[model samples]
Target: MKKVLMGMAIASSLATMMFVPNQAQAAVEANIGATSNYLWRGVSQSADSASVSGGIDYSDDSGFYAGTWVGSLGDGNGAETDFYLGFGGESGDFGYDVGYILYHYADLDDGDFGEVYFNGSYADFSFGVAYTVNSQVDDGSLFDTGDIYYSVGYGFEVAKEYSVGLTYGYYDFDAGSDSDYGHLQVDISKGDFTFSVSRADEDSGDDDTKFVVSWGTTF
Candidate 1:
């Protein structure tokens, strides 16, 4: 299962690279950051492990965007890597996002697949949802268990170079799944540095707390 996830991550990254939007008036940007734990849709991608993550992105003045991101993770059960491609746009105070992400790992089964996501933001609050599709498990049983995830967040400026945000997320899985996930997190930013902490709930495990400290700059 783990190896399969890793393969999906690689394939998704390559797919994004092979396909670029035909556009004019687009501006390119890049950013990189690190965190003690990598969390996705409220699940611990790094488990209790520490990791680093970064990505580069491009956007058009008319509101189209695409980007790739990578990360490293460890969760005791297996080591993990992630690659993702995302597109989004902003119109006035509202914005929307659509993207695909692949999860991969070594010492595990291998295959490629991804999740489709969409979300929108307005003012200090934003919300979004996602679905995991066609993921296969090592046992020859496809993780027919798909996922639906949603989140909401609010941000406030604290200083000339600092801001803070609070977010909440919920996840629901397909049948026979006793385990689900959710999280409430707070993030702080100063200049190009951002730090965050989240209290997570996993259906099958004790509630976990995760922390992230990162530095990023836009160019």
Candidate 2:
């Protein structure tokens, strides 16, 4: 997906990205991006700082796709790499996607995880959910099967080439209800550049409202 459009919606939670391959033919694509701050599921992955990222994706007309993305973790020289595969298609204005993803953090202990996601969309509105299915944490019980996230989003063009998007997301953890959190995001974009602002609920451990400028392109 294009970064600007992807940012305007909630598709999945994997290094700030989710993919649904719906191309009509087999294709290979590459993309690169830079963000003032890398936020994943409403949490700053770049410590409220800047980060650079890039990825390559492959898709087939049959709705099968796979991709890998990597980016600076904003924690010193640490980095995060992600791999995902999924199937997606549309009938008229409605579409659906199902996928699995894995996240790996280099030089970060206990930071690896795996999730499965489902998404459905109609027109400009979208809904999605992801469940944690694997973890590298030592306390696996607390980080286990009960972790899940839900999200909703809507996007529309405000002008010929300018657009606005609104998104809301919630997280639930098995550890405790107190650990749950939610966030809202707004995005405005034209072409390959985007401006965005988001805020996480106080329960998310970080209540700060974040603003970000980002540019991305694919070929």
Candidate 3:
């Protein structure tokens, strides 16, 4: 329980740049943003603690992109930073992404974990599958520890400056263990600033609910 809470806190401290647009033939973008909770694919990326994350991206029109991102996390294991390298492409309404997620700890007792993920999005719906290549799980013997997740989201315009959305995802892992999560989000934009609020829920034996709020700007 303490570890979970600490993860969330570290997630909130890491500011990260996501959703970079490639307008020019060869484009590069730098970004920095923070979120109250680090939720990735319906699972808490942070230890249920606040986390801040950020990174930069470079992309080309040939459908190749690469970037690195880092964040702080809370855990007795001492690994407080995470880094990832990924590539993604969009073909009309369909898109595909593949990346590596690496968890680096500072303590010796806790080892690092790395995973690979592939994701697809069509219109407002997205789905993905992930595999732990070098799972730093407590027990390294856990093999074939893969995860599947899917999400669907649509946005509604409210007034000229406000919009709301509903997003949901389902996660299933090895054995019969599975979890479902949903989010209700609202976005308000004025000029160069955008503010958002989201509520996330996880349905499982240890169900957890969280509320997140964030403010960001785009160049």
Candidate 4:
């Protein structure tokens, strides 16, 4: 499964390169940061611990972009690396993004997956859907493929350089019981540095709530 997804990713990249014009004019940017906890789809990825991450991104004037990011995930999971490519543009007050992302886990067998997503935003509100294209396990198997996630978020400025955001998401497994969760976040920015505090709700179990504080900067 990993081999097949890697091949498709390469083919897609090649196709983009063949059609995109003036690729050399693209803008490149890099960022590094640390998070109190690595969370994905409202679930913890770092065993409820802190994580350091970094990534570089390239964006063209034609709304095509690609990037790779990596985050540390302890508990013998090593690192989680993600490769993504997408195109996004705005139309009047609405914006749309479509993309594919592959999640790879270092030092872990049968732990890679791929997803395709589409997102749209109107003003300060956004909504999106993502579907699992393939998983580490073979296709056509329950819980391995055909899973879907839906999310909605809204953000607004509370004061100068301060903002608050709320998000809710639902994960519907193809084989297991569904899960739903929400997140609330507050952010403050000073120059290139941003501080954030976030709280997320767990879908099940006794530890139903989790909070994290983090600081990050971009260069």
Task: Name the top TM-score candidate.
Answer: 2
Ranking, lDDT, top scorer first: 2, 4, 1, 3
Instruction: State in Å the error of residue 97, model 3.
Output: 2.3
Task: Indicate the TM-score of model 2.
Answer: 0.89
Clash pairs for candidate 2:
none
Please list the C-alpha lDDT of all candidates, in the order they appear.
0.57, 0.72, 0.49, 0.60
Candidate 2 overall Cα lDDT vs. reference? 0.72
- After superposition on all C-alphas, the RMSD of every candidate to the true structure, in Å, is 5.9, 4.7, 5.1, 7.4
Q: Report the number of clashing residue pairs per model.
A: 9, 0, 30, 0
17-136 per-residue lDDT for model 1 (tens digits): 222332467777665655555555444556545656566766665545666666675644444445555666666888676777665555454444467777677887777776777565
Tens-place lDDT digits, model 3, residues 64-95? 66765555553433324556656767779887
Model 4 pairs whose backbones collide: none
Off by over 4 Å in 3: 1-23, 41-49, 74-80, 107-111, 140-144, 175-208
Q: What is the TM-score of candidate 1? A: 0.74
Write down the worst ten-residue block by lDDT for model 3: 9-18
Model 4, 1-219: lDDT tens per residue?
Answer: 222111111111111212122245678788676767665655556776777878878888788988887777756667878898888877787877788988887766786888888888789887788788878865553336787777776767888876655556666666556333444444444444445444455444413455655555546
Kindly give the stretch of ten consecutive residues in candidate 4 with the minimal lDDT sum.
Answer: 6-15
